[model samples]
Target chain A: MIEGHDLDYVVSGIQTLHRVSIRAEAGEIVCVLGPNGAGKSTLFRLLSGEIAPRAGKVTLLGHDVTTTPKDTLATMRAVMPQESVLSFPFTAFEVVMLGRTPHATAGETMADRAIARAAMAATDSLAYEDRTFSSLSGGERQRVTAARVLAQIWEGEEGRALLLDEPTSSLDLLHQHGLLETATTMAERGCAVVCILHDLNLAARYATRVVVLQEGRKVAEGTPREVLTRALLADVFEVDARIFVPEGTEIPVVVPRGPLSKTKPPRLATGALL
Target chain B: MTMAEAPTSRPTPRAVARPFAWATSRSFVLAAGCLVVALSVVLGCAVGAVHVPPLEVLQSMLGLETPHREMLMSIRFPRVALGLLVGSGLGLSGASLQGVFRNPIVDPGFLGISTGAVLFAVVAVVLGGHGAVSTMRTALGAPLLLSAAAFVGALVAMLSVRWLATVEGRLSLTALLLSGLAVNTVAGALTGVLLYAATDVQVVTVTFWTFGSLGGATWGTVLRVAPIFALGLVTLPRLGRSLDALVLGDAEAGHLGIPVERTKLLVIVVSALLVGAQVAVSGLVGFVGLVIPHVLRLWAGASHKTLLPASALFGAALVVLADTSARIVVKPAELPLGVITAALGAPFFLALLLKERRRLV
Candidate 1:
């Protein structure tokens, strides 16, 4: 479990996060959706204990993370950053084995190796275990990094959280679903999972709960059906969209009607607003 | 896909598969490095002004007195030991620095560290004001003063470079390398002024050191420098995991439970100790650090767990071989150790640069 209360963060004298509060519990997938610079990464950083929030408290597994030692917090949560830039030519296996660093006191143990390999296999990256990380394609590299963080929390019990920043950005459609499916499995095994994503339908399909952000503040928070309405998209994303609900489903499938034109206003099928 | 039966009982993929992958296996490279180092140590002991055979060298070393025993014990042994020590120090320091910086091109002297040490050494020589030969013998007597001066100089320069490159606790590699360039130029200018003010004998002494040499190798100097090198060797191996984690960059390394700032400090301090100590004893033996670690990485892969130690072995071997060549290549008159190292290093470096030309431009 992870909770952020009224979190405020400043970067380079500019307020990037403004009194943001959010929480994640075990067995749930929470997706944060926003435009560029919506403080999604900043929020992840604060939750991961990389930076302290000026105005709020962040607690992980009931301990105040601001004062908690990083090594102690490490075993409870794993964070996969936006980009993993490496100059050294480490094999994918070696890169993932780095995830077991916090646990292993000396060199790697047999158990650590098993966990790393299992995580790689889970991410469908076992085929590239011998390949150098730098030689992998973008999607492959992203998945390998995901495997690394997964290996970090592979054996943890409840109260563990996985924070992913744009995990599927480089992934193709099928791989995107596969990555989210893996995250869902992780949640099923009693882990709190939070992902920041750009695609709305993906969020609607995978996220049990969604939080919408505009600029740096949270505008709406609820289940995917309640929060991702046509009105919310228009007001927050500044776009005209059609919301489609297929039969026997409550999940909203959003279809964009292009940008809100200045010369010619948006047309609605209802015809009342025009 | 179905979950595996026992998650924890999965195959140990790292060991079970690609068992001979030289890059990832630590023991193989370490064993090879030890073997090569052992061969080079024997070779260093054998090939000198007097070409004692390897069997004779071993026999003399094991207390079986040969006709060349006196020469072997007095001149060749101390020189070989010092070469091993200094070479290992330089190699390990360079590897650690490159790992911390996450740039293969970096060396122990990357932050103008060696320049600072050279500046202080030149200052000590100019202030001593004696004949080059006499100064060389006695400077080893004031080992504390000289080593302290060099260490302080390196620490100050490194800190300044760090200060210049750091903003709000985050380090910028671009700024760090640029500041290193700036500091090196200023130190070079200072050294030039000292050289200009020096007497003729002092000029000769300063010039000898600036070009770097192991001609002054003695048991006393080797003993004086050993403890510092030992300190670095002890600290570096423990940093293997953190350095490996650092390949992912600072922020991500921290996420992996490494204290990034502390690790960087530890690397800098150990690097300074090793480089400063080597400069204090052997002057600036160029490229042993840069060339050895790179060759090892190219041949055996870039795992720092082995890269750091293997570099020490290869570096010691190369230096020993080069120093041995320095003695015999010009029989009666020995070449400066630095010249020989540069002769070997320059071509290898050029080859590497040509191979990496696309990235360089």
Candidate 2:
């Protein structure tokens, strides 16, 4: 079980997490969804021990480790940051083997290789295990990064817990769906998964539950049907939205509406990638 | 060379030895490095005003029968030994510094460690410890104060850089480069100040030191530098995996459970100690570390496990050959060792910068 008690994350002048609360039992895929500048990445950093929470408690399996040392915290969970600009030309397999660090003394063991290979296979990245990571495409790098996180989380009988910040950002359309499908499957098999996603369709499809954040605070969270609503989108995201249900699916499919229909939109910025 | 197979599935000959195997393509690199070091040792011994022969040089080196006792025994061996030691030391230090800094353009001089050594060496000579240039001057029964100062200076420079440019021990390249430039310029000015204030005799001695010669080579100097090289080579390989792991950036290295701060500190100190000792003895020979690693990387895949050792051997060869050429180029009146290194190094540096056109940030 992974649970947070009064977690708070702040960056620069912004509070990224404000008394955010959450819990994940034995088997569940809890996806966090938010718009740009919503502070999801900051929360992942705090949970991974990449950065310390301003005030709150984080406990896994009944042990308090909010202030645990980095290596110590690594033993309990694994996190994949948004950017993966590695400097050297490490092989894909060698890159994944880094997940074995916290375990120590497990290098080249049968168990280690099996778990690493399985993680790669799970994300369909096993075929390129021998290739240099630098030569991979953006989507391939995303899958490999996800595989590394999975390998780390499953290192021992600890049963694995994963925390990712926009892990699908660089992936292509097929890879995006493939990766989320695998992650959802793993969560069903009893891994506590917390993934930050920008795509509402993916969240609605794969998440057992959904978390909505605006600014730095948690605005809504419940079943996919309950959180993926037009009312919450406008109130929190400040954008008009519509919720659709496809046939027999209980999860709502979300689509956003523009402000142009109500009032003239603000001028566009030239430097923006969007 | 790019890996021919995956680390796991490759047979024992490749997989088990991936961390240690020397690639077939790099055999030339290995041989070129070896051949130069060998040629330098023989030629350096035979080509003085005394004009010893190649055979006699070999005999003396092998501890076999010798013709002239004093010429072959005392003078020649010490010079050859010192050349090999200082050469290899400078090379390894340069390679390790480049890896730690993670910038292809970086070399042993980046953190101002070598400049710091030079500054302290000048200070020691200027302060009138006339008998204490303490490096090769050990034959003259000096205090070794020069080397002592250089070591302290190198350590201080490395520590200052580590403290300022690293945020919680995660080195920021921008900060590191900026700090290196700042520290190098500052340390270099201190050297100039000392040189300006020195007496005529001190100035001459300092000039020769700055030129960096194996001419000052002696058994005692070899003794002082030997342990540092051994310590660095031995310790650096232990961090091969850590260094390789570090390429994934600090956050990734940390995720892999490496103590990033501690690893950076070790690399900096080891590089400083190694480079400072060589500079104290050889007088700031540049480019041995800078050019060799890149050249080797083009041949050997970017795995530090193999890269570190190969670079060390290659670096050792570069210095020994450059020092040898420096000795013979103006034999009766030797050119500065620094001059030879620059002649060899500058061209290579320009080429590397140009060829790395795409990788330039």
Candidate 3:
């Protein structure tokens, strides 16, 4: 439902994403995995139309993202950014209701409220419905935000897409699994789900397809069993890792041993040593 | 898994009950606001220099004959109406601008919108020659010209401040405050330069006007500026949803399908028009916009849908009541409307600064 073709993005004369082409079709959970500064967030931004790619184009539901009206695009897709800073002290329920903004209505209706409540329940955030969002813990806030995007695409209409950026970063282990299971549920409902993830095992467990990135380039793309090998992890992430697939299952479990030895320490884009 | 099916199943009773709570509270605030405006208007008319009494004031409003008919209709009524318009205009502009900027502290006065309007209005009066001040009352087209000039000035100042605060599509609150200070300083300096060249009579007129008053209010003045204020009142509330979306940073607001830049532009222009026309009639009334919205937000929460209209009503009442006190505080001599508002608003502003300091630090 969402496609980015030959995408190239640059910031401050440095390329952040180069020649990256990716697509998520209906009933697919495409997990994008990469190390720090691997251009995953940049790719997410490009697909969500937050920023235009310098080269190539993006299409969502068969319409050019750049040419489409934002209101029209919003109805077909919902994006959850890595972090959101709210200026005012809106209640969690109010924050979730914002997800229904793209729908055609002047104000919140009974149906919108029901959908928002359902989304909150799904994310385990209904317990704090009346609490101010700023008062919530980091994981609580993350789940509330997750509920917002879920509320946005609650209709489960065909050709819809949900794009999540590092949604699990602030989540605890159980909620992390809960959020991914929700994504899987969305995929099963015939919605395209593109998620950027840091945990390989979670990606391996939930992703129908995996796209791995290394230094602004797409290094691997296939099913987790075909693409998530120890050699790929060593080459892209610079880590010694083992991939174990149990005898009865096709799912691969990744266990990292340690960082791979290198001649030099890692450097940032600005050449600052880390 | 049970939660996943909640969309099709009935929501908890508590979930169904909560939205009504906010809705009812909002309605109460709005209703109280209307009552306050009515009471302020009555008190404003009755407690003036002539002391018309509430009964007679109500009679006068109903078009009955009273001893103070000419005084009430010609002087006090227009003044009270002007106060309402100016107060509500400031209040609405402040609320809308604060929402658009996503900052609670910034208002028309702080951002130099009022000063810009004053600068241009002063220039029009001084350049229009010796009789221009009096012409504002007598000449039909003079107030229109002055309002237009003020509108242009306000638009320029608002746009400049927005431009200075924005970097890489992000609006920095620190930059917004600093740029506002810069704009206010430059506008004040320019007004000072104009004052240096004025006659003694012009100086007196300019000084009194700059202090901000509804003393110059007339039916004609009210007629001229009321349409602009009404226009803002109608249009700004419609933008509440967009502004609500905007409170969640720009990119996220866009993700919700708001046209962020366009909404910002509309807010700027409409608020400029409101403040410009208001300043032309009421001078630089400080803190009505800032204080009104801040107070309303505290009472009604931060949703602009309620905040905008509530600000308008409460702002009108506050200004009208302030104007009445301005009339009675010094007794028969009348204080400038700006002095009373500043007296009330400055300390409130200080307290707000302290509250925000915790967050900033």
Candidate 4:
């Protein structure tokens, strides 16, 4: 389990998040949806222990995350940023092997290599293990990086959290669903999975629970059918949209009509590719 | 290099070598580098002012031949040992520093360690006169005052750059690199001022600070430098896995459970020590630290596990060969070791840049 209460973050004297309360339980997927500069990535950074909160309490696996050592916190949660840039020519397998760094005592053991290979297999990236990471395309690189994070938490205890920031932004439609399915599988296996996504339909289809944010405040929080209504869409995302459940589907599907006004063009690009 | 075939349902070579076999493709390249370095060291000891045959050199090394034992032991062997020590120190420091910075082109001197050491050494010569220097050398027997001052100067420069770059517990790479440049410029200016204030005889001693050579090698200098290099060797090779993780950005490395700040600090301190020690003995021999690692990375892969040790071996080889050429090229009057290194390394570096440019475009 991962929980944060009364979380407030200020960056460069601007309040990014104000009095936010968020939680992720085992065996569930919690998706965060927000517009540009809505503090989604900032929240992920706080949860990952990359940065400390100005005023808040963050607990991971029943321990105070702020006071816990980084190595101990690293064992409980894995983070996948938007992009990981490397200067050297390391192969995909070697990159994944680096995920075992915390567990490795002296050097890489045979068991570590096996776990890395298994994680690659889980991500469907085993075939390209020998290829250099820089030579791979965008989507392939994303899967390989996800494999690295998977290798990090592969053998952890229950309630380990996997946090992803814009994981499917660069992927195609099929790959988008495929990647989310992997997260759902992890959720089913008793891991707390939190994903920040821009696509509402993908969030509605995959998220067991959804939290909507606008201007750093939690606007609505509940199931997808409760939180993803037309009024919430119009008020939070500023879009004219129709929400309905199709014949064979159990989740809501949104069909956006257009922007509310021509002055405010639709913000389609998330700028998370870098 | 033939790519290992992907794992199949059947057993593979990687599986067979998983538990016991330590040799990979990178290890093969390292083994080859060790052979070349060993051969070069042996040949380097043979060709000096008096050309001892290679076989006779080997026989004397085993204590069988005593005719030229004094010449080999007293002069040539000490010089070769000094070259090996300084070369390996520079090479290993270069490789490890590049890993810490996550840049392929950076050398050990990127943090202002070399220039800082040179500046303090110049200060030792100019401010401390010939009488003072000789007195200290005779008392301590190894030029300890100059080297100790140089080490202190290097540590000061590195710490200043770190302090300037750090903000709110985070070290910015851009700030770190720029502060290094700033410190180097200041140290270089101070060195110039000291050179201007020196006497004529002191001027010659201070000039050697710029153009390095191995002509001044003695058993005393060799013994003094050995402990510093020994400490470096023990600490540096063990940093391979940390460096491998650090090649990814620091945030990524931290998420992977590495103590990013601690690892970065350790690498910076250790490499500065190694580079400072080399500068104290050899007077800023250039290009071996910068070029040897690049060439070795191209030959082997860029995994620090392989790249670090291989760089040390290849670095030792390159310096031995360069110093040999420096001693023999002009026949009696020796060229500066730094001149031969830059001349050889600059062309190779240009070729590497051209190759990389082609690949980039």
Candidate 5:
């Protein structure tokens, strides 16, 4: 379904993502895995039209979106940012209602609310529908934000895009897997879901194709078994990782090669990552 | 808090919220229209010593066959009309500025726009530039110079704020508000300095201008400020959706297909024109823009499509009603419109903030 001449994305003039180019086919979950500051978020912003490329073309659904209007850029493409904190307190239902912006007259068919409810239900956030969004926990907020993005896309509509910029960054393990499960479900529904992941294991498990970014460049692109090798992890990520292939599964299990150092350097204290 | 806690509350359910919303929407418009009509006639009846009945005031206002109505109609009707025009203009302009800034705390005056206008208008009045020694000095000169000085002052202030606020192709809220505060402080200092140097009569004239009055309201003032208000009224309603999107933040507004930069420009320009014309006539009347929107938003959700028009109407009604009370409260004597606005606005605003203590800063 993704049939654009420039299906690949080219990000230039940046530190690391200057020469990155990648493409994922229709109905596939494409995950980008890289170390911190690998510019995964930058690449996603370019694709989402939040940041303009210095010298590149981003085509979506066969249309040149290099300079497309934000409203018309991707009617079905939804971006769930890292965190959705509002200065004003808006209800969860109200926050989710923003996803219907692309739809005309803001019509609320039974099916639309059902999709929002279903997304929330999948994330175990159905109870949050009538609650103030500000009062939700971090993990619950992420789920609500994910539900909002799901609402952005028209159901059963082809050529829809889901751009997740580290949706599980602030989530617990359970919520993290739950979010990925929802993303996989969305891809099963024929969405071209692209997510940036900090966890290599997550990329290997759910991603049909894993694109690795070194600096601002695309280093490797292939299936979990093809790209998630020990040498590739060490060479690209500068950290050794062990790839395990269990029986009766095409996906490989990824474990970082380090002994998992917990001690912080004397000069720096362990702090929460922003 | 639900309506059960407040007996007088007119709470409309969500199922029938639409029609009640429509009625609340038109109530302000209807109130403003009625106020204008009633005040014009009441103003005609309010000559020096005698109290003209509403009917006699109307007859005199129309120039029908009446023996002594000529002086009342010719002299007082202009004052009343000017008051209405200035009041309506100020209220609407303040509403637009509040909407554009997306901050309920914003008023047209808070940005120092009115200070600039008042400064120039005061200077014009002090200098007696309308041929102070001219024959029709009292009636003609005030409106002419006041409106002119006001427009020029407003343009400069807005242009300065716009220049200060714009950085890297976007208006930074922090910078915009900070610059406004700075300019307001400076302009206020200058106005105070000017007040000290004025002659006794000039001081009184400028004092009235600062405090605000429709006593000097005139047809010529209306003619000058009318088109500005008309343009603001027309252009602001179309920006509702854009403003609604802006509440989500600039990036979000952009993502929603609204032309953010263009929308900001239009809002700033129209708001400036409204404030400029209003200040030229009535001087600086604070808090209507700030308070009115907060009031409406509590009732209506933060939807700009409903908020802007509703704020405009409610702002007009509030100001006009304030002006009416200013006229009749003291009976033979009159209070400056500013005093009335402040007296009414301050307590109400405080209560509003208190009621929503959870949301207050």
Candidate 6:
């Protein structure tokens, strides 16, 4: 449902993403994994239409993202940004209700409210519906934001896309799994789900496919068992790691030993620490 | 948290009940705001030097014959109407501008509209003729000239700020605030220069204009400013949903399908026009814009749909009441409308800041 072709993104004349291409078809959970500064976020930004790639095209749900109007794109896809800061004192429920803006005609309707509530329930955030969003804990706020995006595409059928960027960063252990499970459920519902993740085991468990990036280049793309190897981990992530598959299970579990002695500090594509 | 959650279910009763509660409360607040506006209008018309009773004012409003018919219709009614328009316009402008900038502290003054108007009005006082007295007489003779000068000055400042703040076709909020600050400082400095060079009478006129008053409200002035205020009243409230989306930073608002740049531009232009016309008619009325919306946000949650209209109604009532007190507090001598509002609003604003200091930090 979402695809990028020969994407080349340059920042300050330095190539951040070089000839990278990725796609997530309907009913597929494509998890993108990379170390810090591996151009994963730059790729996500290009696909989400937050920034335009310098030399490529992004197609979402059969339309070119660059030429399509934002309102039209919004109805077909929902993006959960890394962080959301509400300037006003909106309640958690009110924050989720904003996701209905694309479908709402005049104001919020009973159906919109119902869908928003269902989304909040799905994310387990309904308990704090009346709490001020800013007053919520970080994990609670992340769940509320997740519900917002889920509410956005709640009514849509096939051909929908959900793009999540580091959604589990502030989540606790249980919620991290819960949010990925939600993404898996969305994929099962025939929505294209593309998530950028740091937890390799969670990605291995939940993702139908994986795309690994290293230094602005795609190094591997395959199933969890095919792509995740100890040598690949050493080469790309600069870490000594072991990949073990439990009995009767095709899922690969990654266990890190330690960082390689030649590990280089991650640097932005612009060569600036900032 | 569940290991494997069930499929999404219907909202629980608690989930359904709270929104309904807010809905009912919002309606109640709106109704109360209407009542407040009505009471203030009647009280303002009745409490002047003549002391026309409320029953008499109501009868006059209903077109019945009364002893104070001419005084009520010609003088008090127009003054009240002007107050209603200017106050509501300022209130609406402040709320929408705050939404666009995603900052609660911003107001029309942050756009330099008030300073620009003051500077231009002072210039018209000092340099419009041979001496300050002749210019004052001319201004009294033809009020449009001064109003037009002030409006033009406001437009100039708005355009300059817009130009300076635009970076590659997008409005940068930080750049906008910095440019507005720069414009205000320059205008204030120029006004200071004019004040330093002015005669005593000219200085008094300039100072009084800065203090703001509704004493100059006439039928002509009311009619002249009505269309602009009406334009704002019609357009600003319609932006409630867009403004709500904008409270989340611009990028997220865009993800929700809002045309963030266009919305920001529209808000800036409309707010500038509203504030410019207000300053043109009534000299720099302070704090009604900032305090009205902030208070409304605290009372009725921050949904712009409810906050915008509520601010308009309560702001109208507050200004009408303030103007009434301005006329009657000192009996024959009157305080400036701006003075009364500042005296009331500044302390309230300080208290609010103190209460919200932790959140702000």
Q: Please name the candidate that would achieve the greatest DockQ relative to the true structure.
A: 3
Per-residue lDDT value at A147 in model 2: 83
* Candidate 4 CAPRI classification by DockQ: acceptable
- Model 6 Cα shift for residue B345 (angstroms): 1.0
lDDT of 4 by residue, A1-274 (tens): 9987888999899999998888999888999998898888888888888888999988888888778887787777888889877768888998998888878857778989988987776666777787789889888888789888878887755868999999988787876876787777777777898899999999999999998888988888999988999998888888989999988877999999977784476556787555
Error of 1 at A263 (Å): 10
Per-model DockQ: 0.39, 0.27, 0.47, 0.37, 0.19, 0.43
lDDT by residue for model 4 (B1-361), tens: 1011112112322323234334447668788888988888888889977898888889888989667889999888888998998898889988988888676656546667788988887787667655675332331244566677777778788788778877786556667768889988999899988867876766666566578887778899889778888888888888888899888778778877778888888878877777777877777687687798787665566788888888888888888889998989998888988899889777876776575553333
What is the per-residue lDDT of model 1 for residues B209-323, given as tens digits with 9 covering 90 to 100? 6777787678888888888888987889678889999989877888888888899899998788777788877777877878988888767777888898888888888888888
* lDDT for each residue of candidate 3 in B1-361, tens digit (9 for 90 to 100): 5446533223434544655565447789899899999999999999977788899999999999999988999899998998899888888999999999888988888888888888888788777756755344432236677788899989999999989999877788788888889999999999899988787766776776689888867898889778898899889988989999999888888988999989988999999999888888778899988899888877778888889999999999999999999999989898999999999999999999898876554
Q: Which ranges in model 5 have alpha carbons more than 4 Å from their true place?
A: A1-16, A105-131, A172-178, A235-241, A256-274, B1-96, B120-152, B155-178, B192-205, B347-361
Give the per-residue lDDT digits (tens) of candidate 2, residues B1-361.
1111222222322124354445433455557667777777787778766778898888877777777657866887777677777766776676676667776667766667778887877776777564544234542234245566677788888777767788765667667767888898998877778877776767766676666777767677778667877888798866766776677777777766677879988988887777777777777787778877777776666667667777777676666667666766776777888888888889998896686556644
Candidate 2 residue pairs in backbone clash: A87-B247, B1-B299, B1-B300, B1-B301, B131-B142, B132-B143, B134-B144
TM-score of the second chain in each model? 0.88, 0.83, 0.92, 0.84, 0.77, 0.84
Ranking by TM-score: 3, 1, 6, 4, 2, 5
**Best-matching candidate per lDDT:** 3
Alpha carbon lDDT of residue A188, candidate 4?
Answer: 71
Angstrom error of the Cα, residue B12, model 1: value is 16
lDDT of 6 by residue, B117-194 (tens): 778877877787444333333444445566666766776887787789889865666677788899989998999999
Better of 3 and 5 by lDDT: 3
Cα error, candidate 4, residue A78 (Å): 1.2
lDDT of 3 by residue, A250-271 (tens): 8999999888877246656874
Write candidate 2's Cα lDDT for A1-274 as tens digits. Answer: 7777778876677777899877766578788888777777766666555667788877767666554566766776777878676655667887887676666543357777877777777676777876788789887887788888877776444345677788888887777877777666657566788889888888888888888877878889998888877778777666777889989879788887764244547668987856
Clashes of each: 0, 7, 0, 0, 5, 0
By summed lDDT, the worst window of 10 consecutive residues in model 6 chain B runs over B1-10
Lowest lDDT 10-residue stretch of candidate 4 chain A: A260-269
TM-score of 6: 0.91
